[model samples]
Target: MRMLRQLLYRLIISLRTFRKKGLRAGFAELGRTISRIFYQRAEFIVIARALLEQIPPAASKQGLVIRRATTREEIASLSPIADMIDMARFHKMFDHGSFAFIAFQNDQPVGYCWVSEEVDRNVTRVQPPLHPGDACVHDLFVSPAHRGRRIGRALVSHRLRFLREHGYKRALAVVRRDNVPALKVDKKTGYTNIGEMSHTRILFWDSFRYNIPDA
Candidate 1:
């Protein structure tokens, strides 16, 4: 009954979005929202500066090069991962202080991830207060053809090292409980489960939100 009610609510929102933004935009937003609600059961994890030293050095895979994206061309090459947004919006994210790391395999872009030191309270659903030394990792994606390789591990390790070098003391990430692969990768990179959070939304408004105590 609860699931049915949620579906009906989502249908209403999608219809409204369609009238305002057209079918493509409305369906895309609906898909993203549904996916989030489906994965609402998530774990929040944090890695301390001390654990940074304990993490094993990321293995160097042949033909794989991981580096921070600094150019529009490099960012544009990440279209596979950022297909949901236009190039203009992608540039805006960079302009807003969200940094990206791109993975290339023999010159072909395969995967990428993004990190931000400050929360964009206006855009993000969950506005967790970030301390001076804390950074959040989000939007980690790997191409279907490149799964099972430790590309994600390397990307995460690179981000953590970058944060530590810049004087940050901790890194935080959220992973859906059902996403076993992501959970394993984060654990392998030394992130400890810290807590959990879930958000409930009706139309455009968040109805309920709370954190779960760690067991």
Candidate 2:
């Protein structure tokens, strides 16, 4: 039942996108559906954010020691999270100017978040305007064992405060539309729904589209 509902939702959104974006976008969305049937999957991505000047308290209030992992050794401390994260890929992105924030509890890594000053448009072909102070949240994860601890919310809140202190005006985050819990946490932490994006992965090739607000 859940899967069926999601399919229907995708269909509706795709049709709406087609009507708004014209033939080229229509064909692109059609290709995404066709590719999915061939085992090449795609997903709708939600872009949300907090204006740092007026951020709110965390949805799940918890005290944690969050540190920016810039060096290789600091990042290695997150090996406990290796099951879900690829260390090599993390290293590459870090080298490419992305930053990582690791949260520690009782001296063990509990969660981590990645951010970048650049508004990440790698997922889409569209070239939208970017604000210099915008820091895009690339990923956020909390271990399943520590799920109820409100660690995710803590991480986000801390990151926002850090960005604000360092001169960032706003922060952006990417979440799947289906991730209800995350969306809720984001809202509680002062992130407003800003945009939607989707990307198709076919073998080594990828295509993307992001709906710019009022565009």
Candidate 3:
């Protein structure tokens, strides 16, 4: 089912590219899409570390309201805007006591991010294993139309503050090596590059190897 959805998305993209560019461009895009879905691909993931003291004190969103998501209504409100998370996963995160920070602009959802506050409990998706006093932050996203406005940076800053206020000693954020925007946001929020990871997927299974500095 997941693969089918991916193929469907690719098909839609290819068609759009075809309509806008030409047949040659569409075929090239489709070929690349198929290769990605079926062939082995190398993915670089970066691990960043942040201490509580690293959070910026002046981190604030201009004309935007952000808060912890604590209600089913908020989950429903985010399902359409957040592409990476689903309704079921949102409920599970809530049940596990891992809450999300939702950002809204003029009553419309613009961006959101999630944090696993408890290192030991209800953490269904953690990689490289979290150490004591360590928490994982994942899936920070902003609407495309709202990009270039620093909304993502503000969202990450807000999340870091949340972790600091909750007394967590350390926070770990995983970002792809090619995600320039996320890397910039994480850096601006006082996170430092600590390690790199190589990832590859074979069918449904993924394998990762960590490369800590000096390790």
Candidate 4:
């Protein structure tokens, strides 16, 4: 009976290890063979959370560090997708008048936020012209797993303060109405909902789309 029990246990373990016999198993074997390789499939999410936390304490009272992103490479280095268009746009638009902030923990990039001096065409056409010091929160993307920890709020607040210090009177953060998390950050960070626009406005985004060659 003891022999039978031991055999059953081995069978169960073998099934767990090899029953599927697929690509995942092959990768697992590779991982085992290369014991020193560190694989983190969820690395993007971990970094996103870290980015949100690096906002200064004066912005939302969170204890996170904030620093200016010094170069286009620095900005691209922390991007999740690292697209050339995004990098070029950053280089073209970002300045002391407009700033970029990165969040880090233990020297690893976790999140990124930037303000732009450029104004949206629709917003400018419909509303009073934004003051020269006024800036817009262009993009805030954190990894999905690292959300709900107030990192967004901290980043925005820090940005607002930075803009104010640079003599900007107001800060603008355009959020999609359906984007619940972004809208939540808007409310929590004291960004007033001043207006709305149709999604048709996204037509301008065509210029930024990637042109993939036919397969």
Highest-lDDT candidate:
3
Query: What residue runs in model 2 are displaced by over 4 Å at the alpha carbon?
Result: 1-39, 50-63, 119-129
Ranking by lDDT: 3, 1, 2, 4
Per-residue lDDT of 132 in model 3: 71
Residue by residue across 1-215, what tens digits does model 3's lDDT show? 55565567677778888999999999999998778776554545556555646566444457788888888787778966753325556667777777788889888889898887554323343344576777788878898988877788888877777777877777786677888888877777777877777667666665667786622
After superposing candidate 4, which stretches have Cα over 4 Å from the reference? 1-63, 80-88, 95-98, 120-129, 199-215
State TM-scores per candidate: 0.72, 0.71, 0.74, 0.55
Better of 2 and 3 by lDDT: 3
Candidate 4 per-residue C-alpha lDDT over 22-116 given as tens digits, one digit per residue, 9 for 90 to 100: 66775675454343222211100000011212234433324456677877666666655333435544555553344578776446565668766
Q: lDDT per model, in order?
A: 0.69, 0.68, 0.72, 0.51
lDDT of 1 by residue, 67-122 (tens): 89997787888876554233444566677888889999988888888887787744
The residue-level lDDT of candidate 1 at 154 comes to: 88
Which 10-residue window of candidate 3 scores lowest in summed lDDT?
A: 119-128
Pairs that collide in candidate 1 are: none
